[model samples]
Target: MAETEESTGPPATLIDPIEMSKLDTKFREEIHSMPNGEELSACFACSTCTAACPIANIWKYKPHQLIRMILLGMRDEVLSSDEIWLCLTCFQCQERCPQKVRVTDIFFDCKNLAAEEGKVPPNIVGLGKELLEKGQLYTVTADWEREDMGLEPDVPGLSVDGLRNILKETRTSKLVDGDK
Candidate 1:
């Protein structure tokens, strides 16, 4: 028989095994310490949370996978991933979790951490800016439109100064000022 190279999948030499020792094992502990993150360690990789998420189909990492990554100490990967920022805070995941894990809240903590590291998405920053500047996410109705609808043009007892002051005193001010 002629000499031939037989394929047995890819050669083992081409694959690099992950070195577990290098992972930041303390990451799970840090998450658990955060408020509403206390239940993170209770997740058993159940897909219930993912199944309940309305946006999971579009997410690169499903809710269950994100929790698994956090448990595995994949801090940088989890923190920098767009999946963390994509969560809608709808609480469906949390509501469906078999372990009662606060999946949505944990994502909130991850977002806060990401924001602290200046990894926030531009749209979210813009929303914060809008809220700080206008005390509302959407524009108020104009007088003509309100009159046409037989409604008051101005909201009753609505105020923006209080909201602006609150934002100014919190980290949101820094976000609005482009500090992060």
Candidate 2:
């Protein structure tokens, strides 16, 4: 007797039916009006963006799936989704999209909207705080990193104090401080 071979892939997921009442009908239009979001309608659900994404395998919803969700006006789900925060802003998906949908930029627009609503992840907010306070994301502990690149050991005196002062008056500082 021949035994059936076990499938190596993850189990199939059961998709829940979308409720018409929950969908924000104007959501797609809102995204469409944003810069670089106008071409969202061009996506034909080819999954090319998903194929081009380096981290697609780990995504809760792949690139094409996100576009479909936007087109379907899944406002609450899309806005509250942790998936948007997971994006790396790499242009591979955008570059490979036959529709030229500017996938990365569109995601950025979604991120902005989410940020406006204070849906940002804590890690990102912490990074923003670091940037606002230090004027640089990475620590400048040693000069070897610069020396390895054939550059001067010390970063020339451009006062981060002035930068922090100026940034305190900007929107970024408020976002970092959770002011809005």
Candidate 3:
């Protein structure tokens, strides 16, 4: 006779509980070591940070989720999320956070972690390259804007080469390389 249903006690698991616990402990220690991460522990989950973030409206995962993920030591999820890249760095959320959590700085930290792991999105990498090479993110002509304003076009306008050289000197060019 063939047996039916109810055989396994529980499904097999890939994650090791002990390893996960260790990682959580390490992450908490690292967060506490940061200049302002102690503020992270004060979050009351009011979600005001998310509400104040302009980019949060369009994000698949909002700021609050990122904070929760950090608290839970979900490193892979936080590092690989597109929401971190989408942050405008406007500091609106940080300004509005009742807990005084440095949301913008945390996003910067997450972005740096993702970049170190080579997980940055291709489009963003490309834009960084363009900015590095051209010394400008947009092609809007200053003269054209001046003309629209009914003002005399300024002479000795922005020099792309000079800007590019400055960026190179500042070592910002490395930010463009996708392989980095």
Candidate 4:
């Protein structure tokens, strides 16, 4: 009979029970109340979402782990984490979720809440500024590219004034302007 080799490393560390009273119980409830966030509790941490995510390799908190954190009521951690904004909104995780957890939608809600708290990343803030100022995220395409593609060089006009009015009426206006 072959004998098993003795362990060379330190003894296994044991985990103590989490103190339930210390958990932020309201955080999960608040998330559940948001639109498309009602199904957050259905996540079982199967890691399927993480496996399906194309950019999970770059994420500090994987999709499954983000859901787990939200379920665990780590509100400040989740809201402040750049991982929430790192999502590409591709909906791959949402499509792959066995429980249909709407992972991308939940991230959108988290982002909105984070933006309200002035926790958004600088690049995102820049994008918001551009949208509010120009009514578009990108500048008009180059004339050479349009001609190469057999398209008109000049695109139709946009309602910049209307867009500005809409932006001014929305919470995003305050967020973009740093009015908090």
lDDT of each: 0.85, 0.84, 0.77, 0.84
**What TM-score against the true fold does each predicted structure earn?**
0.85, 0.82, 0.74, 0.82
Candidate topping TM-score = 1
- Candidate 4's residue-wise lDDT over 1-180, tens digit each? 111246666654565555566677788888999998888898888999999999999888888888988898888889999988989899999999999899999999999889888998988888888888888887786578888888776676645778877987887688878843
Q: Which ranges of candidate 4 are over 4 A from the true structure? A: 1-22, 149-152
Better structure of 3 and 4 per lDDT: 4
Candidate 1 collision pairs = none
Residue pairs in clash, model 4 = none
Ranking by TM-score: 1, 4, 2, 3
Clashes of each: 0, 0, 0, 0
Quality of model 4 by C-alpha lDDT: 0.84
lDDT of 3 by residue, 20-137 (tens): 5544546644665677677888877888988998768888888998887788787777889999988999999899998899988988877877887788898888887888877788
Per-residue CA lDDT of candidate 2, range 1-180, in tens?
111146556654575556676788898999999998889999999999999898989989888999999999998788878878898888899999998898988888898898898888888888888888787787566477788888776667756777778888986787887843
lDDT of 1: 0.85
What shift in Å separates residue 168 of candidate 2 from its native position after superposition?
A: 1.8
Which segments of candidate 3 are over 4 A away from where they belong? 1-24, 142-145, 148-155, 160-162, 169-171
Error of 2 at 59 (Å): 0.8
Name the lDDT value of residue 30 in candidate 4: 87
Root-mean-square deviation of candidate 1: 5.7
Ranking by lDDT: 1, 4, 2, 3
